[model samples]
Target: MRIGLYATGQAGLEGIVEDIAAAERLGLDSAFLPQLTAWDALTVAALAGPRVPRIGLGTAVVRTYAQHPLALAGQALTAQAATGGRLTLGIGPSHREIVEGGYGLSYDRPARHVREYLQALRPLLRGESTDFRGETLSVSGTVDVPGAEPPPVLVSALGPVLLGIAGELADGTVTVWAGPEVLGEYVVPKITDAAKRAGRPAPRVVASAMLSVTADPDRVRADIRGRFGTAGEFASYRRLLRQQGKAGLEDTVAAGDEDFVAATVARFAAAGVTDLLVSPVGTDEERERTLAFAARLR
Candidate 1:
């Protein structure tokens, strides 16, 4: 499996770039940036792409509701050009709370929204003009970015319907808070089957997990829970945890000694994950240790 660093962009824009460079030096496959409230992920990829030379630069996801397909396509293509064809664009319709409460956009019929979003977005990325009209989205335009190849697109698909949409329309799926059991028994099989039915190549399964290599694993886990416990309250994540026979977000974290951490990562690979994005957790020293150990896996 390909191992990548999940750069949170917590240390600022330059810090993010520096992290990407460090990941490349460590022989990691990719460095994925998240689309939070701060820095724009695509813009960061464009900036880091030139500096980091060889490693893949990607977005863990950019929320689909925020940008129109035409605009997103243009920006993504620009980033792709800037990155010299080394950008993977991951997009998703984030949860209702963030969309409705934060962005003030209705989150009804998310599956339909994603399906239409892809219908319009994909063709535009390929440098083809798109004229698509659906219940949720409509577009009539093309994105022209010279020397930019169409980057592979991945969707954050959790449920079955969205999985089908992702498999048929996008290249693959990106997931979070899903354990090996859910990946092996539910997610992988469901998306793979959808891709087969659509006559597409095998889909990529990119899983993100919080990991730490620490002597006091329980303390690390407690810290993770304190910081990210709200993630377990999200409906989608709650369902995923239940599917994995887990109770909360902390339960999904891989925090332990070197051997235990290695075993945890191995389980994810054994479950057929194509890419693993490790979000190192705990103290500064432990996080660095975690990244070093993950680099060896690559």
Candidate 2:
């Protein structure tokens, strides 16, 4: 399985770029940038693309409700050209809280919205003009991006409907919070079967988790719960946690010393994860130690 790092939610671009460079130096496979309230993901990838040479670049996800598919396709193609065609465009319809509250857009029928969004997005990324029209979205144009081949597209699909869509159209799904049991029992089978029926290649499963190498597991769990408790309020995340038999985000975290952490990652690999994105959590020293050990995994 390929190992990578989540390179977002940090302080600044310079540091994130440096961290990605450091990860590449450590022989990690890729660096995934998140699209939150911070700097734009594609822009960061563009800036860091030339800086880090060997590692692949990805957006953990850029919310689809905010950006049009054609606009995002242009930016993604540019990033692909800048990065020497090492860009994975991950897109999703984010949670209702972010869609309605953050962007002031109506979060109505998100599944349909994403389905139609991909209907327009897939062809544009492949340098083909889109003349299709759907109920929720309609776009009739093409983006000309020279020297830009189609970059792989991954969808942030946690539930069944979205997973089906991702398996059929996109490269795969990028997940957070869902663990081995969820992946093996729910995610892998559904997506794989969908892809097979669609006559598409096997879909990728990029699983991300909050990881920490710590002697004091209780303290880390408590800290995670205190910091990210709001994640439980989201319906999708809450459902995922419930599937794992947890009520809070902290309980879903993978934490322990070297042996335990290694075993947890192994479980994910056995569950059919193609790429594992490690989101290190803890103090500076803890994070450094975690990265050092994770580098050894590569």
Candidate 1 residues lying further than 4 Å off, grouped into runs, are: none
lDDT of 2: 0.90
Write down the TM-score of every candidate. Answer: 0.98, 0.98
**Per-residue lDDT over 1-55 for candidate 1, one digit per residue giving the tens place of the 0 to 100 score:** 9999999977888989998999999999998988978999999999998898999
| Candidate 1 structure lDDT | 0.92
What does candidate 2's lDDT look like per residue over 1-298, in tens digits? 8999988657587889998998898899999999988889999998898899889999989999999888998999999999999999989999999999988999999999998998899999989989987888789899998999899999999899999999898889999888988998899999998899899999999988888999888888999999889978899998888788997999988889999999898999999999999888888788778877887886
User: Which pairs clash in model 1?
Assistant: none
Clashes of each: 0, 0
Q: Candidate 1 clash total?
A: 0
Worst 10 residues of 1 by lDDT: 239-248
